[model samples]
Target: MKKENLPPFKITNEILTLIYEIGELIGKISVTQEFEKNLILRRENRIKTIYSSLAIEQNTLTLEQVTDVINGKRVLAPLKDIKEVQNAYEIYERLDELNDNSVKDLLLAHKIMTSELIKENGKFRSKNAGVYQGEKLIHMGSMPAHIPELINNLFLWLKNSKEHPLIKAAVFHYEFEFIHPFQDGNGRIGRLWHTLILSKWKDFFGWLPIESLVQKYQKEYYTAINNSNRDGESTEFILFMLKIINETLIELIENQKMTDKMTDKMTDKNKKRIEVILKYLSQKNYIDNKEAQNLLDVSEATAKRFLNKLVKENILEAVGEYKARKYIKK
Candidate 1:
């Protein structure tokens, strides 16, 4: 095996502080019942993950369009765009099948992620590549002949390193972008691989939309990559990513608190009714006044009141007009 010089990065005060805060946030998130008990919130977060990750790569589909695609509903999109959505959806659906530390599994992920977007989806590039902003070259990857060796060595390092997973994943992400291993889909694959590494260490990361925060701070993301390359180490990029991860966790914790507060405000009778309705909706997807009446053994007027109360509370959504309206769990 060819030995390679893996890029160097170190843990800093900022990194340690961010990691501790992230740990605190994760502890709060784990103990919160809202995320664990509310199926709809989990599903929505997954949709956000898929939508934002693809959007970073210039996929033009709206969040609603992505949701429709995942639900197996047809939408008018370019074939390439639709294929990209489907490919990402499939990759996330089968994330357990990809081993985070396996180079071969990374290749499989590239194949799935870029199925219809590139000619040689799963393979390393046969020619040199560089990151560019319009006309200026920002960073050049290793020589084409060394791509496979560099990647294998990086994974080897990941396997042997004693670093915390948070730091290891950020290092891997920065190095992967620097390596630019594949012909295309490098950005998406790098992001996906970072998520895989974290999720392996802790499963909730499998659903967290870290990419959403990256998309929100895209300029900072690109700047961090450029700075890391300039410094010949991943310190800059690692710190930036650690901060983003902490912020994402804080958002989840605060939102969970708000949701729990809202749920607590409901009357006991309404809370019981809501639980029954959610159970039915899990099977039926949607219910109208008549269906609600039959399911809950309530009068027609009472059924209308119950369904409308859920709609008002934002726990259920009402579709259509008046007598024709139906309610779906939000």
Candidate 2:
């Protein structure tokens, strides 16, 4: 479908304004700080978790199965469907190599990540398929003969669009999902490739896990896409994606501010206390009063009270019974 002839899709000024603001804030985030390293690790972990969860929800695997793959307890195998969780990891690991503007590199990344699913895993499908809505399918099938040309044209638009890179990436994501080009793994590929495209425009996006935000609203994500397919317009999906991006940015900024405030006020005593907690958490996500007391050189009641206070303030999460309780950073 031609860009102008496709639909009346357009972004609202309100969302455009928010995107610019977020772009500015993200540009200002310092990448050299120790805290930034922690943030990047946390973001990467969340991204993996989100991709894994989505794959599971799509019935490609169970939650336990995806976790096993992520933890390296299982090797990838060609199975019932594409292992999207594995594909997500492959993309993230090789992002540095594909950071340049070469279309060939991007296509190669897609092929490498998806080759197990179909003969054309990383490439567009040569056969036609209909876009679906409920039990109904719309747009009918593209002429089998025209499938190759249609996909090539779509990719050409993706490469040439003059839209804001972020907006273009979002549009391409929706279009790819609507086209359902591959025999399988279309949703996962579309989302991952969109992240790849956006990361090329802004290095910070290489670390931002927008999938986590989308996972939180999966119903909306699917509905927005289906609605746009029915209407032949992607404006709703673009607006929805922009909102997700904005909310994710706000959450990250708020968390960073809180961490900064906590760090700034750290005395030698509290710094030592936090160091003890971090060491314990690095091994496992939780610690009990006994462990805290032993690590922090504090009385049992003092340890309990301090840990409980952190939980109450939303800075930590508590689990298990009173004496058996453990704390985790929120």
Task: Find the candidate with the highest lDDT and give its number.
Answer: 1
Q: Please write out the lDDT profile of model 2 over residues 150-257, one tens digit for every residue.
A: 556666776677788778778878876765666556666677677778878866676776877787788898888878877788888988888888887787677667
> Each candidate: what lDDT?
0.84, 0.67
Residue range 132-224, candidate 1, lDDT tens digits: 898999988888999888898899888988888999899999999998988888888898989999989988788788999999999999999
RMSD of each: 4.7, 4.7
Q: Where is model 1 more than 4 Å wrong at Cα?
A: 1-4, 31-38, 265-330
List the lowest-lDDT window of 10 residues for candidate 1: 1-10
TM-score of each: 0.83, 0.75
List candidate 2 stretches off by more than 4 Å. Answer: 3-8, 34-36, 39-43, 46-53, 56-68, 74-83, 99-103, 131-144, 267-286, 289-314, 317-322
